[model samples]
Target: MIVTWAFGHLLGLKMPEEIDKNWQTWQMETLPMIPKQIGIKPLPKTGQQLKAIKQLAHRKDVKEFVIATDAGREGELVARWILEWIHFNKPVKRLWISSQTNKAIKEGFKHLKPATQYDALYESALARSKADWLVGLNISRALTVKYEDSLNAGRVQTPTLSFVRQQEKQMDKFRPQTYYRIELEIEGQKALRVQNNPYEIKDQQEAQNLIEQMKQHSGTVVELSEKTKTENAPLPYDLTEIQRTANQRYNFSAKKTLSLVQSLYETHKVVTYPRTDSKYLTNDMKKTMKERLQAVANFAPEVKEYIKAGATVKQKAVFNDVKVTDHSGLIPTEQRASPAKFSNDEQKIYNMIVSRFLTLFANPHKKLQQKATVAFANERFVFTQNKVIEPGWKPSEDTSETTVQWQKGQKVRPNFSIKKELTKPPKPLNESTLLEKMEKFDLGTPATRAEIIEKLIRSELMERTPNGLQVSPKGKQLLDLVNPSLVTPDLTKKWEDELEAIAQGKFSSNKFLKQIEQDTKQLINEVKQSQKKYQDFSLTQKECPKCGSFLREKNTRDGKIYVCSNSECHYHRRKDPKVSNHRCPQCHKKMEIIEGKNGAYFRCKFDGITEKIPNKKDQKKKMSKQEEKRLLKQYSKPEEPEEGPLSIALKEAMNKED
Candidate 1:
């Protein structure tokens, strides 16, 4: 029988403390907004779990080791890493299934293919890992060194940071300008959005004149039109879609909820997979919905009602064999489960997956729209309204997101007449909406999007705002420092098109990797050639020596410093730097380490205590030595002396006695 590991990573990585000295400082953070990276360190149970994993991986009697992981990239990698770390040499094959029923699992095992078939998938995953390691490690180090602060960086992170900072700038500059328009109203209807322009009256008094003019005029419909439209149930919820929605609805951070969902997939085995970007099942998966639905009869009693409702499971809504690439879209397995082990966040994700499953077989959601134009004072006003004629897959639920839009539209215009005004910001790009946009552009996959967001945050290239992602001051500086082409979404899109080619065996990973390597080098060289000096807002009492211009503190993507006023004129030589993980000795917190005209200093992340590196390191080491200076604990403890001076002296006297 195959053995299992605990719910954790088993190996192929150094122990946390071995990787870095600071990890031994096991003092928990006062504020645990994030799970510390080292907290991922395997526990004692993890070791026992790994022993089981290894024993299973090494069984010679086993004909073919089945890679039975949650069907996604991370799941694949997690299993692969364990096999690699344990040096398991058994022949391998994949047992792929979406649902949790024993029948599905057994069928999948019977249909298992050689593990080598997934080489391309593994290759892509490895590429992601190596690229993240190279870029995240190197760029993060460079920034930390320059800033004398522990700065984070990653491939997706820096650009994501830019995306956010851009929004922040927009928010900062936003000034709401009021506008006025004449609206025509009927006995039962409200006004609609038609032509909007300057008020008929120029001044506010004239605007009051327009309102008065509208008050004097009667309303009449000049034109009317009606149309009907149908929307299939939304495609399956990919990981990013789930993440974005979860963040929006529950105020769960993107990263926080990701971990929760991951556990739901791997540890709980209730969800099919959480890291997959594909939202459609392969054609084969749709065939077993009845069986899949039956498996969950214990928890969601609603499934039986659908079967009773004469819903015939259709192949059209199920998986498309041609569309399935490396992984299939997420779905819940047919496993009956108790919610006892699930955290609140996990329950939300579970509900979403189950609801979507039930929705697939429901009828098509139908919408009807009516648009009308009112001609008054030779100026036209337009009104529009949509009513849901039939709720398709979303039958039981009175409202979903799409439904809300129509509902809100109706609420805003109960009378269905011409409206005076309807002005709203472009739908704010929260985590979910942005991913939708990114997917539309085919910019990146689910596995990579989270990393991109994480990288931007770690690098301080962007940060979370109440509104959404925003670019950091440093992110702006770095974007300007680097060539524009290096950081655009186009870079990933272009790479994705090529990656798709490689997946089809039309191109090679080696060729694409080579091109990317070359591009990265060129990008770095361009940044190095820039003559821009570092600047910090705090460093203001100086002038550029060469330009004789007042030097002001400035913040950049790389760090902080002072530079010349002129952008084009020659000023200074370039220097490289890296971020430190070390905390400030004085403030006992991670410092805002920076490099520049003033050289390296550690400004506390919390306290704003700025100190040089020597002072920082010395303070910590000295503090540790002082804390260990006492022998009182040693004296009180049992079986202490190994070879103390007292023992040594006794040994010499004892030797003479012998």
Candidate 2:
């Protein structure tokens, strides 16, 4: 059998202009550009690859084809589209396997299934692509034309942006209330407020009185209890879970984590598929546990003990066929990895996958929990602590044990103080938190979630800051101006449910596309009729040099740029001067090259020093007296130390201390 591959889909759905000439112009009259039938066209960049595949299919010796792309819906669509585009009528077989290990691939070819079995999956993928085009492109066009602004609204991304906006709104309106709680410091352990009726004082005077009263009265232990608690090991890493963990731990974006994991899967072949949603393994995979563990043990000798202990483990939660989908939870393959050959990033991600897998076989974590309640001045205060009874899977856990000997009705003297705390607002949604919400709502699949997040940032609907992800002013306005349904997960959830049904052959692709077309028309009409006004929030005071139209400041990977607000005028330039190779003699840093009235010049941002770039013929020219005087005058003023918010806060704190 001949093995062939295509770099993703060589042919994509036809563009609007390809379908009809009218769609070349962005007009509300041509809103919802739903073609009579969605057509396919070869993408220009991958045309050569497509031609090679076509040539291979046309060879007389090649009697049949095997679809061996990714073993999921999108993968199925990729192979099927290529075959259809090539117009090959030969018989086709499929090789579906979750992992790319040599054994799995060999077994997959041995049990190759017919291509017809995956026809429904291809249909589902087609329906998704068409629906996204009909809804996303049309609405994005409608909003841009109606408001005369660069705006993008989508089925999944808009809702995801709405989540960030909602979180920001909650934080904006949050009012912090001051509450006081009195804690007793007895033998270093601070007593906690008891549940049901916490010792929280709202009034400062009342809190002070209670603190004084508690200090006078001798405290007595009213209740003491001890119990054993067991926590089961964490389930294996699904794609989303690993993404979240990596983001929280290393501050890696969802896209970055996915790429790293994909490299570990596709390039190194050390792990299973990186795009699974399930965290459970199939029962058949249980027999391969020993070999997989031995491979991991070779790579990470520290986990060898866990692997050995886990080998005898018969944990029911580790394996469940019902929870698995197209692929199982991500785990190390039977191939032992060579850490020295992998990049630092790949090693980090690989360790996370392997670490999670190790936890699956180890014993449950057992701890001894102790609680003590004390009554002082008719108020109850409690303290609870846990000591590990068994390290189990998490041997690195904090197993520090502390013994507190306090019997019921025992009298004790303790000092008390009131702690003043203000209620805190909810934190902004970072990539990690946002992915969790997206997964909870089923906004997108594991493969598409990272892309959906990136689309929002690229569209400038949301931005990442030190605090977390926040919706831009344009995004906040888009949420108001767009159809309300598009900003909620409900629409995408409904479409996804139907798409799944189509994949199962319970729904028709034609009917699904028809419904999407109808919905697109309705959404477009709503956008066109809405009287809500949109302002270019990023509009700069300057006009475009090319078209005299107002230019909007847009953030890009290469820093900021000023793009003409007028949709027709595509004039754009970088907002800042380009940094040149010339280094500032004083600071040894790269200086920005600017075009001055004289000629090209280099300027240092630190001390406002400037230097003229001499031409080749005038390379020996020395600095003139006037230029020397200007430089001295520019640096004459002594620079004051910058006082930012942190500095000012530190000053205020010092004043308070004084």
Q: Please, what are the lDDT tens digits per residue for candidate 2 over residues 1-658?
A: 6666788788889989889999998888887798888789888799888889999899999989999999998999898899999999989999999878899899998999989999999999989998999998999899988998878988999899999988998998998888877777778889755546343567778878867777788889988999999888888899999999999999999999999999888888999999999999999998888889888876556567756565654456878899998989999998889888899999999989988887777678999998898988687888788899898887888998775777899997877777887878899999999999999999999999999999888988888899899898998899999999898999999999999999999999999988888999899989988999888789989988798988889898878988898777889878998887677889978898777777779999987788887776685476655788999999897899889999999999999999
Per-residue lDDT over 1-658 for candidate 1, one digit per residue giving the tens place of the 0 to 100 score: 5645435345433443455665433322211111123122344556777777677666667765678776655566667776776777768888776655565677877898887877666656555554444444445444434443344644454455555555556666765554555454544444633554542323455555545555455545666777887777767787788888888788776677678877776667777756676778876665556755765665565678766755355326556766665567777776665688888878888888777776776677777777666654555566666777887765554542222222111212212222233334443356766666666656557766766666566645666678766666666776655456645666666766776665556777777766766655554454445565554333345667787765544445665545664444456422323446666677565555566576777666566667676766677666553357565666667875579898899999999999
Model 1, 304: alpha-carbon shift in Å?
3.6
Q: TM-scores across all candidates?
A: 0.66, 0.87
Lowest lDDT block of 10, candidate 2: 192-201
TM-score of 2: 0.87
Instruction: Compare the candidates by TM-score and give the number of the best one.
Output: 2
Model 1 residue runs over 4 Å out of place are 4-64, 73-90, 141-152, 196-220, 295-302, 313-319, 367-369, 383-430, 437-444, 458-461, 465-467, 536-658
What lDDT score belongs to each candidate, Candidate 1 first? 0.60, 0.87
Candidate 2 residue pairs that clash: 310-361
Give me candidate 1's TM-score against the actual structure: 0.66
RMSD of every candidate to native, in Å, equals 16.1, 13.5
